[model samples]
Target chain A: MHPADEVLVARYVEEADQAAFRTLVDRHQERVFGYLRGMVKDRDVANDLFQETFFRVIRALNKERGSYTRQGKFLGWVLRIARNAALDHLRARKKWQDLGNGDDGDESAWWDRLPDDGPSALESVQDMEEADLLKACIDRLPPEQREVVLLRHESDLTFREIADMTDCSINTALGRMRYALINLRRMMEEAKRLEHIPASD
Target chain B: MHNGKKDILLHLYGEATDAEELRSLLRDEELRREHAALSEAKFRLDHLKRERPDPVIMDRILAAAAGEQGLPSSTDRKDRPAVARSARMRKVMLPALTIAAAILFGVAVGWFSSQPGTAQVDEPAVATAPDDIVPPESLYRFVPPQPVTPASTQDPRLAWDDSAPLMDMHRRIESMRPEGMLDWGEQAVPLESLPGSGSRSLQLTGSNKN
Candidate 1:
């Protein structure tokens, strides 16, 4: 059987095995990128955040490898890193636009800085092809709910780990996930109804 | 089995895996309905597409991670000294550059304040045409004098005229017939296409209520 992720993390940390690190990246990069792309709704920005996420993990590993401790699961740990980096980018970009950069290109900057209490930012993603409907559904979720869903499903994080990462009670995390599912169902139903109506031309 | 929303959610997600709970859940009608709803939601969620980053991005990430792992390739080693030198220069020059920028900024601000013609920084220049931007003849524009009217002299009904369009919109909405199903059941009304409809404002006002 293949080594567990913790084993790979240990090998990479203790022996500085580049291959082990690469394997870890290969293993989780898709999920990480998926989460990022869903959040940012921009391919280039998602790719940038993906690289930044691994770079952060590498830095943290270098600093405390000797005392490295597996927290719940490796995927959860990396996901927390990616989440923080993505949020930081959002917050920083928000701050950047609040200073009034009114250029045409700065339109996205303004919307990015708006409070993400809801998926108000994902309206643009909703207009993309049907393949992106899933993204649009996830984007429709409140950030906290979306985070819980991504962590629970994509990263396979336990509710306990998700609670810890999000600084909420386990029940709160579970509730967010439940709401996310319900919201996604609603979005799907709406999409189907719209699809059934014949186009004018 | 039908303990609460929490239990139903957990059970639907397969987190509640006890045999006894599963057996009880099967027998509870309310819980079964909840389970079906949750299951349908899960199915919808499963249909979402997964995003994958480009392979080139993956390679760049791995290479950068490798560099951090102290497993730099021969090319990296050769470039190390040059990179270090460039970094060193940046560290030394960045502070100097900041100080230089601060001095230049202060000088510019001082010069701008001292110059009478350039003092109004807050007001944007309103150029009449793109090709020729005429400098304003004066710092302040002339305002035509008006005969002042007493606050009580104006017609009070005119003050509420702004509500006319709002009332009209409300009337239109009240007259509108809803075209589709009610209780969207979670599906939001598609307001996106309303603008092209014959009675767009009415449709938007009506559909949004659904």
Candidate 2:
């Protein structure tokens, strides 16, 4: 069995064992990166935040100076870092505009212009297309509902934890999930209807 | 009784402990239909793909871990108040203590010069304060202790690890970088994006390519 996250963290922090740190990263980087990508809605920015998250974790764990102890779930601790980095990018995206060049004055267009990278490992073209439609539908969800869905589905956090993370009650988090389901069903039905419509020859 | 939506969700997510009850509830035609729809929605959400993080990021993280091994551990972030207290005392109290010592020394020198023994240097006829006013016992009591220079002889004020306070100071200075060079101003997320993003699975799809 794989070592627990806390055990990995303890080894890395206390011993500065590079291999232990690698194991920790391998285990959580995907989840953290996925969360970041979902929040940033861009792959490159997600990668940047991914690095930053681990960097923060390394710094935090190392600063304990060999007396490291687990305070909370290591996944939760790192997720918080990724969430902050994504939030920071989101907060900065509007005013800072283009990263290097300042000329992209339109705030909304930045995310809009990110090209859809298409589907993942599905076998059939139809499955890929359907997955892409669902992805787009999710991407278009109201921020609150989308967040609830992502935190519930992606982060694997309980509704209570999601509520805490989002600064809302458990009931509110559940309600958001319910509403998100309703919206996604509607979007999927709409996509199916559109797909059935006869193509203009 | 209509199953509460929250209960249904909890059961569906496997969070509720009564799996048998949930399974029985789902056997009802109406509840089963509702649950089936919910399951589909959840499946879609779960099916959302993860994009694999780039190898470069992995390499960077490893490199960072290696580099940071020699550096101070950030364990002190939690003990900020204690560190800050020590730092604050050193910054504010040490100088204040030095100034207080200097003032006491200057007062002792002035008082000594005003005594009859030293008054003869200025003018022999000058009347000194009465012996009752300048108590010799009090003068001896006011004498400063001799300074000890050797580290072995010096009294330990704060009996802590010698490296600890230095490490704390280093961490304190390092903490300032967040506001200093690292402050990337004003750029942030759109208010609309505040709720959430697409899904986490996408991070496992491929390289860090957009």
Candidate 3:
């Protein structure tokens, strides 16, 4: 029931309507931010990349308004930009290898450094911890697998779109997602099992 | 054929996997177990905290949008004092500069029009040749024929005499000739051999001398 992305994009491009652009940013900001955060494993860096991604989006919309074919794929387009921005930052900082499995010595340091400001309620705290654990597990994934999981879960892109964006076959994209999910489930189960084991005095 | 791990994943993600193929894959205990684990993982991923970028970042992006559209962005003005000042100056000076330019243009047009030899807009244009070049004398030598005088203003002797005899008129016309020559058809003959020509010639010569 929401206004189509094409309508909002047309309003923004033709009328220079800032509200329409803001609407667009609001609609996809969380997805893009989450995807960037997952990719870079840092909130501040994700914020910067988020801003950069939108800046690139605004500039592209203004410069090449015709390039967006208005097929309701605006989120996918924005996610692609966000992914590229995150990858560029990663490459620049020589952190690309760090995103692979067990390569970086301090791969878990960023997760430990994340700010803990969730709600104080017991259930909310548990949920937050679980979420944090899941995020850490996702971070431990290989870059390709993490990318597929983030694009699929956060952006809700189809495997075909993920493949197209990531330059792989659809089957390869699905395979990556399969491995990522299997790894995450195993890690979560292992963490739960460890939580149940009693410690000696 | 569609019971591969990728097909299971595609079916798990709600992609275009066949319903029958998915049912058949789930019938296998191991594949079903794998499906349940992936489903739990995907559910956790879906429930993962969706982090929004700081609102300040959104404000900056909107400000950029405003700037690109040539609209004023009040955001971040405090941080960019010089840019804010320049923008303020532009807002105040732009119209003033435009008015000054317009006044200067009007004054220029008026000054040029008031200069000597500059044509006024209201006057009808006339095409005139330049005065420095003198035309050939032959252009001035052509005199228009004189207008004929009315009989009342002409000398009586030179007036047409409609009632006079044809021969008398002819002789008169012959006498009025510049030299004593007679019209003999297409040729002019000297009147020296005519009977009265000798005396008339002497008289004409005497009158001419007089």
Candidate 4:
């Protein structure tokens, strides 16, 4: 079994171990990036926020080596920071029209920007298509619902943890998750219905 | 074992739920259907793509962790020139500010010394006697003292007689004492001249007198 997150954090903080820090980043980067991507709905902005989030993590860990006493909840703490970074980006984008520019306009813009090496086989391509569809549906969710879903799935946090991170009641977190699932189901059914509609001659 | 949606969710997500509650939830047709749909939705959500950020971003973060670079800003590459310019300005402005502050301090010191009434502490103190000496009896009459010249301008060779006032005050206090009080002048009293002379002389000689 690998060392726990707290052990890795201790190694990184006390010893200034770059390898330990890299392990932390690697262990959590996909979850963090995926959560950010779901939050912002823009790959490039998510990339920026991902970097910003880890940068903040490093700074906080270095400056406050003694302050990280949240023994087993490292990913939850990091996701909270990531959530704030994504929200700040979104708020700034909303405040200044010129900040995001054309980036925030088309949610599907990231699809076009996907790397050319993606999913060469037919089965993988079909899976990618289904993922893309589900992502679009997730993007269509209300911010609160999407946040609940993303934090739950990406970070694997409990409803109580998500509630604490998002500053809501545990019941509220559960309610949002329930609504998100219901909405996703509805949207998937709607998409399937539309896919089955025959083209006009 | 009555199951609410939250209980169903807790049971669904593998959060701690009663086994009886889970069995009851699965037993109810409506709750079971709801659970099935939500489970399907969750499964689909799990299939959502996970992407990694560019390795360059990680490198920058690690470099910041290593203290080789500053905190990574969101627009690092786009704002590098501005950052560099700011750095160059800081490098030039810091020493310039130190020199400017030093010069300002020097000018302030010079300007203050050139002012008329400022104390010249290093110059030897000049001691001058008062223009009019008051007699010891007149000390009680509150004489309005003369305005003394600044130490820097007074004659350094004249030594101040500071003890004159103190001696006068001592004489005034001595005159205030009651007239009949025994003056224990500069000599010790003899034991034979004591109030109880025999007992006092015996005590002093350490002899018992019956």
C-alpha DockQ for predicted model 4: 0.36
* Model 3 ranges with Cα > 4 A deviation: A64-72, A97-128, A199-201, B1-3, B68-210
Q: Taking the candidates one at a time, how many backbone clashes does each contain?
A: 0, 33, 0, 0
Q: How accurate is candidate 2 locally (lDDT)?
A: 0.69
> Per-residue lDDT of A8-94 in model 2, one digit per residue for the tens?
877876787889889888887767777777777778878888887777877778673322347657787788778777777776654
Query: What TM-score do all the candidates reach, one by one?
Result: 0.55, 0.55, 0.56, 0.57
Give stretches of model 1 more than 4 Å off. A64-68, A94-131, A199-201, B68-210
lDDT of 4 at A69: 61
Q: What local lDDT score does residue B59 receive in model 1, on the 0 to 100 scale?
A: 82
Q: Which candidate is the best by TM-score?
A: 4
Report the poorest 10 consecutive residues by lDDT, candidate 2 chain A. Answer: A95-104
Please rank every candidate by TM-score, starting with the best.
Answer: 4, 3, 1, 2
Error of 2 at A134 (Å): 1.8
Q: Clash pairs of candidate 4?
A: none
**Model 3 residue A122 CA deviation in Å:** 21
- Residues B1-210, candidate 1: write the lDDT tens digits: 114667777777777777687767668787677677778877765656666788887787677766733533436647978999999989999999999999999999998877867655533453334445545773377758898997545544444566878777655554443443334465676655333365434454445654
Question: Can you tell me which runs of candidate 2 are displaced by over 4 Å?
Answer: A64-69, A94-128, B1-3, B23-32, B68-210
Candidate 4 per-residue lDDT, tens place, A72-149, comes to 889988887898888878776562121121212232233333223323222222234677778777777766777889
Task: Identify the CAPRI category of the predicted complex in candidate 3.
Answer: acceptable
Tens-digit lDDT track of model 4 for B1-210: 223777988888989568997887688898889889999998887776678888988898888888898874546655987989899989999999999999999999998877766655433342343545567898679768799887745534335544878667755555544432346784566766545455433465665566
What would the per-residue lDDT of candidate 1 be over residues A1-201, giving only the tens digit for each residue?
A: 877898888888789788888888888876788777766667899898887777667767777332236753778777877887788777766621212111122222322333355454334443556546766666656566677777766666677777787776667676667667766776666776666666657
